[model samples]
Target chain A: MTTTSETAQAAPPAASTVPPKAASRAVRSKNRIDPTYYWMVVPVLALFAFFITLPALVGVFFSLTNYAGYGDWKFIGLSNYVNIFKDPAILQSYIFTFIFALTTTVVVNIVALAIALGLNAKIKWRTGIRTVFFIPMVLSALVVSFVFNYLFSNTLPVLAERFGVTPLATSILANENLAWLAIVLVTVWQVAPGATIIYLAGLQSVPAEVYEAADLDGAGSFRQFLSLTLPLILGYLVINVILGFKGFLGTYEIIVGLTGGGPGMATQSVAMRIFSGFTGGDYSYQMANAVIYFLITLLISVIQLRLIQRRGVSL
Target chain B: MTASTFSKPVNKMAPLGLKNRSGRTRKSGREGYKVNWWLTALMLVASLTVLLPLYFTVAMALKSPDQIGTGTGLAWPNPMNWDNFAAAYVATNFPVAFMSTAFVTVFSVLGSLACSSLVAYAIARNWNRRFFRGSFVYLLSAMFIPFPVIILPLIKQTALLGLDNPGGVVFLHVLGGISFNTLLYIAFVRSIPVELEESARLDGATTWQVFRKIIFPLLAPMNATVGIFAFLGSWNDFLLPQMMIADPALQTLPVVQMLFQGEFNTNYSLAFASYLMAMAPTLVVYILAQRWVLSGVMRGAVK
Candidate 1:
């Protein structure tokens, strides 16, 4: 090693050696590692590992055993995995989870994109309108769902009754097909504002020069949107998809408040399934379900992030 | 819907018909005039679907339970039963829950900023290190690793550490958020030029003095935005409390809200009343911070 270093130092006359020297210097510096950031993370990493990483590991371990929330944990190994495929309700929950995610994802994006475009138009009284629209996002999902329960499911029906039309209450949530749609509608309403806010931020970052060029080229609104706006904001579009997916996996409050995953367990998503299991005193089993669901969400999110990053348009 | 002293042709060309002056123009050749009017109107109605329900909520929350639950009381809660809010306070464990929430929110915010920023400063200002970089990426990816995978271990760890209490819960939340918090702060620290630090160094300020006296103050803007967001996030969080906080004395508002789901049947009006009560802080905070908050999100997007 000493001879190698001595030769490297002594024989480095080539032009390319300059670049290699810098690269090696970087490697060496990286090896030594600064303590500043590391020290700062002492408290954070302690908490992160304790609360986030450790619990995750415990959850995975719990999934492999029958803890019953107490008593000796029997190491059943792959039995939990087997029961996942075997149990119809468990498999059905996955299907419903996917549908819930897909539907809410589409609806939130379309509505948010439109609102973002409107906001981008810079209409009069927009701040007021935007404030009005964005207000729902501030409410916890439980709170939002309760308000909607009265307005759409109860009060709107009363108004409709006055006109002699059948009430439009979401008693249909007790039905299998419509229950999904009901939750979807409420979910879209609650989250659409958040998506709009993100998109609006993205839209604002588009340079005025790009738009000016589009206008000068005789590009109309649609043309400009197609060529300039869409291409430029692909990053935001992908982000919205990921956000929608997270929202789907994480959604428990609204589903719990609105339907309790009822109508024969139709609307019970993976999150809901875990929650229900927890409430029902089947803690270990549900944690296993959550672990499976988590893996699926992680795989999908990583794939999506990778794909978008690969295709991302660098500014 | 009222003609509004504007015309379609005008707004189409000029993007008019809004309630403000986005630019110095009255009307030009209607810019987006000929585009689909139905789509915009549909969007408007859809947007109103969000507003109208909220309107109804405010309307009913003003009424007595008798008025709200019975008869046609949707027209501004006849004579405005403002006592509904007072009743809501008692019915929902409002005071105690608020205290719990406030206490939790305070610690979560302070802890997150402190832990996240310290780590962030280290990562951003410190010299290049592969170990740190690798770990940073690992940490960021872990956020997407599904809560179920980590949540169980976290519970075990928290339990081991006696963090299952309310304060402990806040501690867990702060730690849970460290990765994202660090990401935000590290970015902020990197954006600060090195010249400031070099100048401080020339003046012989200790590293802590430089950070406290200069770096921390400079980071105030980004800190405000991130802090407020983290505060709001912790305050509104429902899932953790639902699973964790078992003691009624320690229950947050969202936890109390869940109690209305009684076995027999729920009192819908009382539940709705409680829901509105729970939403007050979030609504108030956003309203107060919106001017800065909106711009903050814009700034964050590029970073």
Candidate 2:
């Protein structure tokens, strides 16, 4: 690094016969360290270490013990971990959380991509339509869930009854078997617009010349889209899927607002379970569950970073 | 490949009419002006579907008690009863909740901006240094650590330190938001020319002065983005404040609204009215800053 800077400085004055070593030293001194930069970063780093890193480490320690969130007793290594696997509620939450995340990721991606494609076209009222779609992206998830709860409970059923639809006569949120679907519907509604914006950006970046070239070869629109557009936006798809999946795994407020984990805990996410544990005085067991959850997210994040790096996704 | 290459030169001088035809087709294709009315109509329906819940909330909020339980509540309220809002305002203690929410949002936005930008500036300016680079990576990794992973111990730690109030929640919000905000600021800071700060430094301005006078002013756009994001996150947040602030008087708007909903579950008008009240601030802000919010989502996604 030092040598490159030296050569760069020396290249501008090739006629001068100055010593390379001396010139490099001069440039290095010109780039002298500012102690204030170190000072400026201290508070941020301190807060990060104390508030984030320390608590995380403490959490890991507590996961192995019988810490009731307040007065602690002796450590019981792996007991909480063992109990987590045996607990039906935690296991059920894990299953529901994964199901919710996977289903939402797939559905949101397809719908978002479709919306992006439509919005990208030269249609009338494009900006107005885009804004309408994107409005939910800015609203609070909790608020949106509550609003939807009313619709599912009151409005939709009333409409269903008027239309003579037998199945929808009852509120969906009150049904154990179907309540998770309502949560998924709301999640998709709230999240698809944000994904649509990302996909729209990706769509905009696809070169028009590629499609034009394909047209000259007599390739139809579907073939052109398949052969040209999807490949170019594959990176964006990976990003949306990973980020959306990880985010949905942390779902809490929406569940609280909609069904409050449902008629029988059928829709409880891992986060809901963890919070309940805190309130229920099952602190260490929930700490163990949280640690496992942390590791799963960490693994997925690592995989995502690696995939982006390998694909060289600039966006 | 050889045949196509040789034929391309010969076909390059094809009829002018044919060329124009192809050119027109290409232009039309590029602009996508061949309107698909079906798709346009479909998108309109989808937008309406997405807006239905919001429409229902507002409609329900505007209805009276008699109008709500009836099927006609789906339609607009005839008399347009405004009493529900008043009842909701009283029941939820809207003034106290609104104040608490505003305090958390404003302070969190301000604190996150100040700390994250300073650290970001340090890292961006000292890009070649090992420590700063390490700091950047360390901060970025914090993004992977979900809040639930540490909430149990965090509650204990905060309680032990006697910081379990709205103030504690604000501090946590500022800290929790620093990683992403710092990342955004670092990207913006890198684009700012160092010569401005260097020249100021050479003129004997302290490093703090250089940052305060030059660098900070240059980061106004990023400050807006981060501030809006921090505001949204803090305002919408329920879990941290719900867990941290035990006192009913100190609860944020979302938590208060949730509790309020539980108390007045049977009063659909008052319930929906309070819901609208809770959501109004964000909706207003979103409408005012829709352009920035949209662009910011795209930009943040790119990172």
Best by DockQ: 2
**Best candidate according to TM-score:** 2
Q: How many residue pairs clash in each candidate?
A: 21, 0
What TM-score would each prediction reach against the true structure? 0.85, 0.88
Decoy 2 TM-score against native: 0.88
What is candidate 2's CAPRI-style docking category based on DockQ? acceptable
Backbone clashes in candidate 2 total: 0
For model 2, residues A225-251, the per-residue Cα lDDT tens digits are 798889999988998999899999999
Worst 10-residue lDDT window for candidate 1 chain B reads B1-10
* Tens-digit per-residue lDDT, A203-270, candidate 1: 75566677777677888889989898888788888888886887687677788777788878887778
Model 1, B38-125: lDDT tens digits are 5555556656777777676677677666776644446676677667677778877688999998998898888877767776776676
* C-alpha lDDT of all candidate models, in order: 0.68, 0.80
Error of 1 at A194 (Å): 2.1
What digit string (tens of lDDT, one per residue) describes model 2 on residues B1-303?
A: 111211243432121101222442334565445666777798899899767777878888999888876583568888998999999999989999999989999899889989999999999988898999999899888899999998878887888888888889989999898888998899888878877765564444566888899989888767877887788889989899889986888888888877645633578888889889988898887778676666555555555
Q: If you superpose only chain B onto the true chain B, what TM-score does each candidate give?
A: 0.80, 0.85
